[model samples]
Target: MDTQLIRRRMARYVEMVDAGDIDGILGLYADDAVIEDPVGTPALVGLQAIARFYREGLGRTEASAQLTGPVRVAGNGCAAMPMRVDLMWNGEPCSLHVIDVMEFDDKGRIRSMKAYWGELNVERRPE
Candidate 1:
């Protein structure tokens, strides 16, 4: 896979998330893709489960994510980015510093995504 293409896709992921474009976000993944947001939790498999996960997390909230550093791409169809996600969680405004790694399928769609984050990475955001 071309590293440039992987970088573009990685950047697009953040853009779509900030725009709350659920469909666009889904389009980034393959039909059989899997996601492990904040890895260690059970992975969400397939587009159906992925759709549910995004819907519940976004849910009419002003959620947004911004890349904090350049996207790191590997020749092996993988890329990772560090980003800060600002959103309303449990009715409280907060932000999380997260690093997300994604693997691309032969078709260029994301095949697997694993987000690395923990409670220590979270902070309250001023409304």
Candidate 2:
């Protein structure tokens, strides 16, 4: 995929998340996509697993994400975006700083997504 296209897609991902558009978010992935959020957990394979993961997480929470930096494109068909996500988790307001690296398939769909964040990157928001 072209770097510009990937950048646009990454931006769209943030827009969809902010809009709480799950279907639109999923539309950016390939049928057999794989995701490992925060990168060490078990991978969520295929669209169904991915859907369930998002539905149970972001879907169940009041969540919004913003890109903190420009999308960085790699020589390979991959791009990464820096983001800050604020959401209601377990009835508490919190935020996470994340960097998501996505590999795109030939069709320009995300074939793999690996999020880089850890507990240190998470912060509790004061009410």
- Per-prediction TM-score to the true structure, in the order listed: 0.96, 0.96
Clashes of 2: 0
* Cα distance off (Å), candidate 2, residue 15: 0.9
Clashing pairs in 2: none
Total clashes in model 1, counting residue pairs 3 or more apart in sequence or in different chains = 0
TM-score between candidate 1 and the true structure: 0.96
lDDT of 2 by residue, 22-123 (tens): 999999999999999969999999999999988988898888999999999997889999999999756789999999999998878999999999989989
| Off by more than 4 A, model 1 | none
| Best of the candidates, lDDT | 1
Give Cα distance to truth, residue 51, candidate 2, Å. 0.4
Superposed model 2: Cα runs more than 4 Å off: none
The per-candidate count of clashes, in order, stands at 0, 0
The 10-residue segment of model 2 with minimum total lDDT is 87-96
- Candidate 1 per-residue lDDT, tens place, 7-125, comes to 99999999999999999999999999999987999999999999999998875788888999999999999999999989877789999899999999988899999999999998998
lDDT of 2: 0.92
